[model samples]
Target: MTDGMTYRERARTAAHPTGRVASSPVVRHALGRAHGAVPDPVTVFDDETPAVANLDPELLRALRRAATDAADDGVEFFVNGGWRSPEYQEQLLRGAVSKYGSEEEAARWVATPETSAHVLGDAVDIGRLDARAWLSEHGARYGLCQIYRNEPWHYELRPDAVENGCPPMYPDPSHDPRMRR
Candidate 1:
C-alpha cells in the first residue's frame, strides 16, 4: 500500500479515462496538504500552510485574535482541518459514507463538496481538547462559533456573535439548512 501505485492504478481504472495520476488518493492527499490540508497541527498564526492561510479573512482574523488570547491562558489553538479543496471534501464525504454504511448516516458528519463550509474557507476544525474548550467558552467574543453540537471542534465565523453571542448550534451537518443544498 505504501508503494503508492495501487491507489494510482485504482484511481485511473475506476475514474480517469486518461490514466491521470492526480485522481489517486496519495497524490490528492499530498496536493491537499500543499493547498489546505492540515497534515500536522498548526496554529492560527501559521501562515505558511494553506489550511490556515486560505481561511476567510474575517474568520482568520477572529481565529488569530482568539488564538492570541488563548495563548496567554496557556491554551494554544491548533487547526486540525481548514479550507479544504472541493476534491478533499468529496473524499471526506465518500469516506464517511463508507464508514457509516450509508449516505444518510454520513450526512450527519460530512457535507457534500458543494455545501461544505470548509471548501468555502468559512470553517475550521480546531485541534486539542484544551483549545476547543477555551474556544467554546470565549469564542463568541471573537465571532467564532461552533456550528454543530455534534462537532465541538468545528468552528465558523459569525460576526453577529461578537455582539449577540452565537446562535443555537445545529444538531449536526444533516440538521443544518445550508447542507441541504
Candidate 2:
C-alpha cells in the first residue's frame, strides 16, 4: 500500500469528513470550481463527444497513452462516465434499485455513493462495444483492469497489473466485500 494506506482508506479520506464531497464548497474550490478555473484537465476525443475529466492524475495519463495506442489499432476509447459527484452516484444507485427491483440486484450495478470508485475518481465506465473489447484484451498493458465480471465496461487503474496482470474479477459489486455496508 502507498503511504501505509490501502486504496479504500485513501478514497474514504479523500471525501469530506461528513462523507459528502459534492456539498463541500472548500473541496469544490480546491477542485477548481470557485474561481472558474479548469477543475481538471479533460481529454476530448472529438468535438462531438464530451470530455473525460477528474480522473486520478496518473490514471488519466495512462488512459490517454492507452487510447493513443488503441487508436493505432483502429479502435478508439470512449469514456461513458468518470469522477461522478456523490449525489450523482446516489441518483444512479436509486435508479438502479428501481430498475433492478431490489437492493441486492442494484448493488450489482451501482455502488453506494460514498463508497463508489467513481466518487473517488478511481474508476471509469467506457462506452462502445469495440472499445470495451479492445480494453479487455489490452488494458493490462496500461495498468487498467476490469474489476467486476458483470460490468464489462467498468475499469480501474491497477498499476501492479502492468507486471502481474489484474487480480481476479469479483463476481459483481454485491460479491465484493468492499460493497458491504
Candidate 3:
C-alpha cells in the first residue's frame, strides 16, 4: 500500500509547511539522530523549543495534531527526531555495546535496522519528557501510542496502517541475550 508521497513530502505539509519549523525559528529541528534506541539529545533549546527528534512524517502528522490541541490549553510540545541515518544508529549501537560489552551483546540489547521502529517511518521521538500527563491523557485521539516500556519518549503511528508494513500492534521485544549483537 503506497501512500504516494515521500516522507519528506508528507513532513512538509504537516510540520514544516512554511519551512520555518525545519529551521530554528518556531522549532529547533535536528536531523533525527539516535542514541541507544532513543533520540540523540536535543540540538538546542533545553526549554521552550520542545524537542521532537526521530519522528517519522506519518507519525508527525498524528503528533502535530496532538501538539496543536495541547497548545490551545497552554501546554507546549514538539517532535524532535524522525528518520535516523545509519551513522546515527551506529552511535546508538556503540552506546549499547559499551553498556553490554561486545558487538554481539549490544545487538541483543538494542535493535538493528531490520527490526528498528524507525524503519517504519511511523515511530517518533517527542519531547517534554518531564510532563507526559497531557500525552497520556489524550494521545490516543491522534492515533499515537507510547509502546516501548524501556523508552516512554518513543511514540508510533497507528500500527494498522499497511503503508509501511508495520504490525497493527507492536510485536513483543526479544529479551534473549543470545540473539543480540
lDDT of each: 0.78, 0.67, 0.50
- How close to the true structure is residue 5 of candidate 3, measured as C-alpha lDDT? 60
lDDT of predicted model 3: 0.50
Q: How big is the positional error of residue 5 in model 3, measured in Å on the Cα after superposition? A: 29
Q: Which ten residues in a row have the lowest lDDT in candidate 3?
A: 42-51
Report how far off residue 81 is in candidate 2 (Å). 0.8
TM-score of each: 0.81, 0.73, 0.56
lDDT of 1 at 167: 98
Cα deviation in Å at residue 132, candidate 1? 0.7
lDDT of 3 by residue, 91-146 (tens): 66689889988876665445665565654455566667543567666777666666
Cα error, residue 59 of model 2, in Å, equals 1.4
Please tell me which predicted candidate would have the highest lDDT against the true structure: 1
The candidate that achieves the highest TM-score relative to the unseen native structure: 1
Q: Write the per-residue lDDT of candidate 1 for residues 67-135, one digit (tens) a residue.
A: 766766777778999888888888889999999999999999999999999988899999999999999
Please write out the lDDT profile of model 2 over residues 1-181, one tens digit for every residue: 4368643343334333342332112221123222121233322232112224466655655666667667667766667676666666787889999999998889988999767887777887887888789889999998999999999988999999999998999989888887765
